[model samples]
Target: MSRLELAAARLAKALDDLETVVSPLAKARESAAVAETKIAALDAEREALVARVATLEDEARALSGLTEEVEDRLDGAIAEIRTALSR
Candidate 1:
């Protein structure tokens, strides 16, 4: 083959090789973008769940306090009934 034709053929092969390399890289970038978006969404969801858990903990503490107060009142009533019965 002529030298010019050979050079042109080599150039075409080089372009094809570059495309082969660049195509996968482009696809990888696209996949990474999608993964980043999903991660951001999951982070937001996790934050919301954390906030909800904090609120539930506060409510549980309040309920525990109320339960203690009721127990105290019930104990006092039971002691009074015992004294009356002993009289």
Candidate 2:
């Protein structure tokens, strides 16, 4: 083959080798972008869950207070009934 034709063939081979080396790197970058997006979505979900937990905790505390108030009223009513029955 002529020297010019040989040089062209070498250049084409070099380009093919370069493409082979770069293909995996490009795929790795795409995978990393997808992973980052998923992580961001998870972080947002975790924040929402934390807020929901705080709201539930506050409601539980209010219910606890109401339960104590109910118990006290029942105890007073029982004592009053006992006194009336004894008379």
Candidate 3:
């Protein structure tokens, strides 16, 4: 073949090889975009769960304090009964 024709054939072969190499990268880019979207959704969900947990913890703390108050009152009544019996 002539030099010019040989150069054109080589150029075409290089282009085909480049396309083969780039096809997988294109798919990978698409997959990365989807992964990023999923990650954002997960982060939002995690934040909401954290807030809910905080609210539950606050409620539990308040209930615990109420329980302590009731116990203290019961202890006082028991002491009064014991003193009366001692008389």
Off by over 4 Å in 2: none
- Worst lDDT window (10 residues) for model 2? 20-29
Candidate that would win on TM-score? 1
Q: Once superposed on the true structure, which residue ranges of model 3 sit more than 4 Å away at CA?
A: 77-87
**Runs in model 1 with CA error above 4 Å?**
none
lDDT of 2 by residue, 1-24 (tens): 999999999999999999999999
How high is the CA lDDT of each candidate model? 1.00, 1.00, 1.00
TM-score of 2: 0.82
Q: Compared with the true structure, what per-residue lDDT tens digits does model 3 show for residues 13-49?
A: 9999999999999999999999999999999999999
lDDT of 2 at 41: 100
Per residue, candidate 1 scores C-alpha lDDT tens digits across 1-87 of 999999999999999999999999999999999999999999999999999999999999999999999999999999999999999
